[model samples]
Target: MQTTQFMITPASGKRLIAKALINYAPVQSALESGTLVIIAGTTNGYLAEEILSSIGQLEDFSREKFFRGIVLPPSQPRTENGRLFDESGFPGDVVIVDGKWKKGLTIFDVADDLVEGDIIFKGANALDVHKKKAAIYIGHPQGGTILASLRAVIGRRVRLIIPVGLEKRVSTDLDEIAMKLNSPGAHGPRLMPVVGEVFTEIEAIFCLTGAKAEMVAAGGVAGAEGSVWLAVSGVKQEVAVAQKLIKSLSREPLFSLPENE
Candidate 1:
């Protein structure tokens, strides 16, 4: 097998990941045929922009300060005296059907019309690479969107697509971690282990390039922290294509957090 090594920066990695999600065969088909629900966060927020805007026109759809789901930890000065500014997900939801973005659709509204074959996209905070499982941070006492979406996704056979980066990979057993954590007495957010189609950068690269990519190394200093290093193995032509894809993403801008976030 042919092997090619790569060093990807964090921000550029997210862009490549976004590109893969937009071009994923199943996702593309689902967007065209079934209802697509996006519970946006920092990572999926980038993807939401990619889905709406064409390549080379990302600037047209990249600003979404209010539409992101983020955790506001109590350690931050923003959280004090039990006042939480946690907006871990957009207050609302976005839906797309027939390859067209539909506005003004709420998750509740989506559930009313949800059916099998439709897709629910949710982001996660942590992934267990060994177990191929993912866990999400929940600020909502009632379990938030994941729980609501699970009803339709699990019960009705709707597809749940989780587009997360390798940056969120965790070494601990997610279930074990969840056991020690509970929303009531937790100093911070509690985690909920989720069952879904977890999409990481490795999967994204394979989906986009048809090449098997492995995480050979990780972490870096001088602004490359949280970035992933991969060893992609494939035929010569496939490796070339993967290289080109990575090149295109090298200049991809870092997704900026909306001011006052």
Candidate 2:
């Protein structure tokens, strides 16, 4: 097997993950004949772009304000729900039904309508890579979109796909962390361990190029913060494909909030 290494910044990783999902079995199947809810989040913003593009309806969609809540630096102001204080331009979640983009709808609008074979794409704040587990941070009084998605996921057999980056991978056990964060006196956003297929950059590489990718290192300076160094190994052709694929996304600009925000 031939091995190759590539440095993928968080933005590039999100793009890569989104590219992989463009041809994902579940997503393709859902788009053809079922419902697909792309919950509003930073990472899912990239995914919404890709999926929309795949269906030739990329026009009128912008990732700039495609998030409900986001994590910002200490200097930035946030609401109790961790969203920016000014939530005026917040776009609703991307809900696509039967290959049509249902504008102005969210999980709450269609959760009860989803049934078996449908899919939901939600981003995560933390991941347990070894166990393939993921969690979301919730500051809403009621559980957020996750709670609504769960009704279809665990209750009705709809699929939940989590497109998270390797940067969110955590060493601690998610269930244990959830326990602490959900304790009576716990302060701050609570963590909910979610059940879903955790799709990260590693999985993106394999899914797109048939190469196995292992995150060998992480972290960087300047625009490379939260970057992951991946060693992709496979047959000569596969590694070559992986290299080409990574190159196309290496220059993806860092995700930034709209200037008006």
Q: Can you give the TM-score per candidate against the true fold?
A: 0.86, 0.97
Candidate 2 regions with alpha-carbon error over 4 angstroms: 77-81
* lDDT of candidates 1 onward, in order: 0.76, 0.91
Candidate No. with top TM-score: 2
Total clashing residue pairs per candidate?
4, 0
Q: Candidate 1 lDDT, tens digit per residue, 72-142?
A: 44556654443336545334566777676766565667765788888888888899976778999877778
Model 2 residue 235 CA deviation in Å? 0.4
Q: What is the lDDT of residue 16 in candidate 2?
A: 93
Model 1: ten consecutive residues of lowest lDDT: 54-63
Clashing residue pairs in candidate 2 (N, C-alpha, C atoms within 3 angstroms): none
Q: Write the per-residue lDDT of candidate 2 for residues 1-261, one digit (tens) a residue.
A: 999889999999999999999888888989999999999999999999999999998898998878887887777654444677777787799999999999989999999999999999999999998888999998778998999899999889999999999999999999999999999998999999999999999999899999999989999999998999999999999999999999999899998876666
What is residue 187's positional error in candidate 1, in angstroms? 2.8
lDDT of 1 at 129: 75
lDDT of 2 at 239: 97
